[model samples]
Target: MTNLTQARLFRHENLPFLLAALLLALLAGCAGGPAPAPQATPSAEEAQQTEALEKMVRQGRHLDAALAYSRLANRAAPPLREMYSLRAAELLKDGNYIPQSFQLLSEIQGANLGPEFHIRRVLLTADIALARQRPDEALAVLDSITSQLADDERDFRRRYHQLRAQAFEQLGQPLESAREHVLLEPLLDDPAAVQANQFAIVDELQQLTPQVLDGLAADEFGGWLALAAIGKGVDDSLPADELIARWRAQYPQHPASEATIARLLAARPQALRTPRRIALILPLGPRNRYAKAAEAVRNGFFAAYYARPRQAMADAVPGDGGAPHLEDAGSNAPPLQLRIYEEGRGAEAFDAVYQQAVADGADLVVGPLGKDAVSRLASRESLPVPVLALNYGEMNGAPPRNLFQLGLSPEQEAREVAQRAWLDGHRRTAVITPSTPWGDRVAKAFNERWLALGGHVVEVQHYDPKKNDYSLPIRRLLNVDESQARRKSVRRIIGEKIEFIPRRRQDIDAIFMVAFSRQARVIRPQLRFHHAPKVPVYTTSHAFSGTVDPQMDRDMDGVMFADMPWTLAPDALGQRLKGDIARAWPGAARRYTRLHALGVDAYRVIGQLNELRRDRAAHFAGETGELSLDADNRLQRRLLWARFQRGVPQLDTTEN
Candidate 1:
């Protein structure tokens, strides 16, 4: 039926009347007109047929009911033919005997028919032909109803064009189909209608020949027509945007046109150029341990910026000058008080410095060296810039939105040692650590890494650092023939009846020793007592932090450990820092290289502050080789492995 008639039939309040009309139409044919003076009786066959059809229909056996109705309509009279046609239409609505119902309706002569019946017959015939893929037949049926169709039946017109387009597409006439689509486009203002039609059109175009699309003009529909066609095509070489732009230009006033264009444009990637200003806040004061270290960091940053040729440096540094604005954290009590308490008690002294930096238009904030200050800074909130808090250990509280900590931990060192040793073929390993909590922490990290890398820990023994005795734990970890003791017990039970053969000793491939320089010195010789001198030993970074002595370097030789690259002066940055330290303090050994390397790396990566803040995977080359931020934004350093050879700690080139 026409859209209006279909809507009218399905209306909520009119549904009961429609059903009653349908029932009456069905009953009229069986009753054969109004009863003649109330004395007329129906034939048994007629009554049986009516009862069976009604019972089947009520029971939802629409196909069986349709056949009964068709047989009944064949014998019905002229006056009752309308009821036959109506019954057939109802059967068609039930989606049973679709073609046969239409065929039955088509047999009706133009007699005393109302507009509703005429519309119903024509629409139902068209629906059947369409369902059977006979679009030409459906169009012919629709053409017969054109004069009777109402002007308000716009949805029918749209569907007519849509179906015509589908027929044309099936006939391999894509251009005609496209023209019909353009004509129907006006009725697609509703989102649901547009989406449905768009999908239908796209699906049809996929089956059409590519030459149809190729024949279309480049700038057609400002390119939406071409894009839609291209989107339908299988080839990826189509110029998508050009087609879309043409289509959009043609239909600029169309609803959701701009939104579609914006969505399509947004899908393309574009690089954003955002300028960033970083603030370095450091304590530059007399007699402070970090004063020279801070200066060395500043020098390192300047060196990185100016490391290239003059033109490259000029391009990198802002405004042709390479100097960065630095705010000293101050040595005097008043300035420190002003920096901290100007806000509040718990507020950090660096807060004011940060505020000043923000006021000066900084995008990133870097320092405030001391642990207490960094920890206090971490606890506060709502900082204007992203802060890279540079404390040496894990901070006390939650960091701010843009704040990150970039410090090394003993756990991190232990994990690195375990990974390196496992990668270096150390499967059967032993761990000899001190009884302190720090030693336990190292042991835990080592155990985790060793287990993760599919290595077996032969033994884990703890030793007291204060005691001079290290022979017992060292000997137990190094000795591995427990079968001998088992054999001895068996011998005692069996006497001379069984002679037990001794099993060969299994030497531990490696030892992960956790101790200070003094304790390490005592334990080094004990490995020789167990006859496992050539067994490789790995230590944590604490071993390199002023713990190794020159006198005991021979005993500690061949012992490899993970440490910052600055400890061995691996690169130019490390070498420069070492030179500065030697020039500043001639008598001072390179023991302070760890602290120096921390400063250099912290400064060097400041250039990548934005990337570091945004991307957790961003890696940087530092005085400690390669470094990356972990999930918590803690700096995980790519440590260097140094071997103590002869009388000096030599950097291991092969493993890092």
Candidate 2:
């Protein structure tokens, strides 16, 4: 109301109390206290701009909203200005404008912003690098931040670690990636997700060698390696309380106690089955040709059978001991009622020996370690008990019940080579193998699997493995000589000579070859000599000598082969066993590494074969390979792939 109106009300005679109160309020106002300020209101242009930005965001026009935020960023107040840039970056990133987001984030001054904004900018920058497929760049950006974060900042810390892991994985630094995963498990909320991420860490570390892990397990790096080991190797066979207690003692401060050990105890999967009565049928006779081979196997079986989680942890490397590496747990199951039987002079005596072993109360018979003896056993109608024969054999009729075969089969490797080549997009293949029954077997296996996978066999050529000159076979395989023949014929007929380069067969995208070291040294280079160097060559494990012979193997470079886990072990235990075997019988390992793997698996499978057979899809991760049960009672090994690089067989990253 106006002052004149108030004055008029005060002058009124009626309603004297109201008029007196109004006069007193007017006098009080004139006596003046602090003046009341007006409420701030949006100006027309500012209001319109704010509404437009909100409208763009609400309507899903992210680019327009991002542009508006960018335009308004300078006009925004201090912290709000950073928020505007960050929001714009987020919008740009979602729209796959990585470079734009990166540029915007790069321009942000973290020193002038809150710690949260600084973290966001760094994370956004790393994410942008990742989006551009520049993991190393992303890692470099992330590395500028330290591991130490404030209590309120753990979310950003976790994001930093997650992005670090992604960058490491993209850079093919799996062990580092796995370490980050170990750290990340605690940050994860879902129990299942935690377990899955823990398993992923285990799976990744399980692919590294002890030699490699040992190099890294210095300082803080050791904690994650130790955690992953426990996840992979600890099972029901271990005393849950004791195992975790021991781990806690060594790594009392590690987060794995909560992330891994506690969860494992709760899961309570059944312990690895330990057979009550076991018989080891070996070729241990003094004069037997396979005696040393059997010895390698025996050592391997004993090494695994006697191993302990603590002992493996205590040793420089797991499974590096000769035998009895750990004090007997005593609860792992009574030392298997052990019996040893030797195969006699003839195949005719095999059945008798097996029967006698069964009569002696053997329940799980491990082997007749030789192929002939296995073939003899396969001839029987049925076995008295479950028998896991060491070598797969040729049998006439259907495989007998309660009999399972586990062999280090070259044929399996050959088939895997074909499958791998096909998987790598090899449409047609040329075959050049030895002119022998063994070569025929392997070639047939490769061809069958390749054709089944819709790959074509362009041609086949045989070579003399003993011969040094492989030019003829290589030329035939590549059809280079045929091209030369056609060129010469054309030149003679027309009486004209023009520059011409002979072209190898274009239909074949890969070569399936079978060669031992002796042949490989010549065949590989000879194929290259025949102008087929660029055509990928896939071969059985025979192409690689079990032991590295750099000078001799140099020629085999660029050839891809399928080998067993025995030869290309992906785990520390396997690597350590290999080291132990080499130390004990260096000479035998030059040829018997595969047999050692067989021995290890033979003992392992006795406990797991039933599980595998029950579930056809199940695989036992064994030293030999991933062992799976086939319908024919054979435990087939799915081999590892490698390419000869710089005279070394490097495991293919694509291999499982």
Which candidate should be chosen as best, given TM-score against the real structure?
A: 2
lDDT of each: 0.57, 0.68
Candidate 2 accuracy as lDDT: 0.68
> All candidates' TM-scores?
0.46, 0.55
- Candidate 2, after superposition: displacement of residue 240 in Å? 32
Candidate 1: tens digits of C-alpha lDDT, residues 315-426: 2222211233222211211110001101112236556666776786766666666667766766666456666666643455556655666665678788878866754656
Q: Which candidate is the best by lDDT?
A: 2
Candidate 1, residue 422: how far the Cα is off, in Å? 1.4
Against the true structure, candidate 1 reaches a TM-score of: 0.46
Instruction: Report the Cα lDDT for candidate 1.
Output: 0.57
lDDT of 2 by residue, 512-619 (tens): 888887888888888888788898888888877787777778888888877776676546777876776666666776687778888778876776765676555456
Candidate 2: C-alpha RMSD after superposition:
25.1
Worst 10 contiguous positions by lDDT, candidate 2: 1-10
